[model samples]
Target: MVFSNLPQQQRELPEDGTTNLWGVSRLSEVHRVPVASLRPADSPRHQSEQAEHTHLLANSAQELPPIVVHRQSMQVVDGMHRVRAAELRGQSEIRARFFDGAPEDAFALAVRANTSHGLPLSLSERTAAAVRILTTHPHWSNRAIAAVAGLSAKTVAAQRRKLGPATQTTARIGRDGRVRPANSAEGRRLAGRLILESPGASLRAIAQKAGISPGTVRDVRARLLRGEDIVPLRHRLDENGRGGLNENRQSGERRPPVARLVAAPPPAPGRDEGGVSGIFPSLCRDPSLRLTENGRRLLRMLELHTLDGQGWQSVAQSVPAHRAQIVSELALECARQWQRFASQVRERAVAPVA
Candidate 1:
């Protein structure tokens, strides 16, 4: 699997700060470093004589992946077994790859590399490594911790619970290794602005431009269409910068009342005899089950036109497609509703009384 957020290009770092060099170009060169000069950062989690060692020994006649080393401390991060296997072949120096980072970061990389490849880490080793990671990267979420430590999120959560709460972190590392802030308020605001500017823009396009979820963008568009204020509420301030509820105290004027559409109470239980009830009887009986506000408004408009004596043929001919497409879509929707109602009825009929 590809590791996210790891630097793939070679770059220099300040003398005091750490630098990460990745890619096969950096790790491709197999430097022959003296075995005696190399030191293991931590004890081997798995026995070197396991199947991996045997396989390495069997392939000792050929080339193998270079061992990973820390350039700063000369500590071996991975491939202890390969180093030993090479030594058994009477080799003084072994091929190696180098990574330059803090010891802690190197250790974390080591744990991840070892667990993800070749021989797996033992349970105790994995637990210890997870604990160390939690202590070092306390802001990481349970899933993030688990991803790097080779454990389940539940296991990481349990470990965290045992250690109690830690400082909450708003930044999270994604699978691609990029760090992103969890907050999306700015994104939502941008989406709202875009929706207001381009009312006909597709939700997917708006979501992509705003870098927010499509669902959130859809909700913003719906609210805008409903005439709901998307702007957040702010405290009103006077000319002197004093905040108060009474705006008239400073401006000496009252703001006009904003017009809003409120749903007329679903006509009391049995009162819809002549209107919508004559049509969708089930929906009229159940106020909770009805079309969206826009749909209801359209339906009400049609009812008023019919009351004004406009025949169905006149209405159908007035539309561009001659109402064929509209009628087909409505019929399909009715069929789906009927199918669902039938299924529910059958289930209730067969259900045991309880």
Candidate 2:
């Protein structure tokens, strides 16, 4: 009945009655395995709760959920209470859903199942489970261990700290299932090489490839920029007795320039006291202030217009005071219009399909 509710892929029974156990697979049809072959895994449930559950199941005619078992070991990962209840009823066989993994993985599943169901694991029990998980899965992050053990990451971290320095030097397993180096030295060396090869690469990208923390990569980059030799001594030595210390200084070799944040240049002297020229002094000194190519062309045209004797004298006599203000406003409006048009075009180009 449970198998009927599952999707077509899961509902389909294996022809040989032996499903391939790998990764995570949806629960298929339950198999009636011999009760004598089903060994209980280390359970998080207290003995008192187990006895109470067994008594309840004996009086009721209800069919309990299938026990989760490891395919290779035939060890019960979850539903230990149901297994015990079946024994009390003198049942020769029990229904079971098989999972494919090692014993440590089965332990994680057992802990998760116990906390999620009836008579949840207590705080102390959860902490103890976290400690055990940390000991078994040293590569797992504190958050990952916490997730499996049903405890907070803070609690997991505290348990790890209690485990001492050896734990800190253990390999770290990331969510991607890749194992990182036990210590930061190898990571730093890799990061150093990457930085040397591609000085302009993003720090985050370099860190990811090296499997090192971004902060660590950043520190390595900073040291490189400071001309510090953070690379290991072994890498610094060549096949010959010569060292790579002076490699950059060798003939025809150019070292990568250090990247430094430069402050913006100070704004040029603003407008002159006389306001003789229509252009602001700052605009004349800074090319960036032109805002756009069209704006720069218009400014050049205005300068040529002022050079013409007839245009210059007529403008000076009529509205000399407002001439600069008018020109500046026109330039700003032109730049604003160009920016708005560019933005609209981009928005239309990237508009979502209905």
Best by TM-score: 1
Off by over 4 Å in 2: 1-29, 46-49, 55-62, 71-74, 88-90, 99-101, 181-208, 212-354
Question: Could you tell me which 10 consecutive residues in candidate 1 have the lowest summed lDDT?
Answer: 10-19
Error of 2 at 173 (Å): 1.1
lDDT for model 1, please. 0.58
Give candidate 1 misplaced runs (Cα > 4 Å): 1-28, 43-60, 182-354
TM-score per candidate, chains pooled? 0.49, 0.47
Candidate 1 lDDT tens digits, 1-354: 111222332111112101121122233356778888898656437454465554455354445556788888898887766666666666788877787667777777777666656456888788888888777776665666676667898798678656754623445554344454434455666887787577678988998888666787887666555445332222233344323345454567554443333343343554544765345433322222222355445445434432223454676566676777988798689779768967987999999999
Per-prediction CA RMSD (Å): 19.4, 17.6
> What is the number of backbone collisions in each predicted candidate, taken in the order shown?
4, 0
lDDT of 2 by residue, 269-332 (tens): 5523344343433343332323234655645544443243455567656765758788768868
> Quick one: best lDDT, which candidate?
2
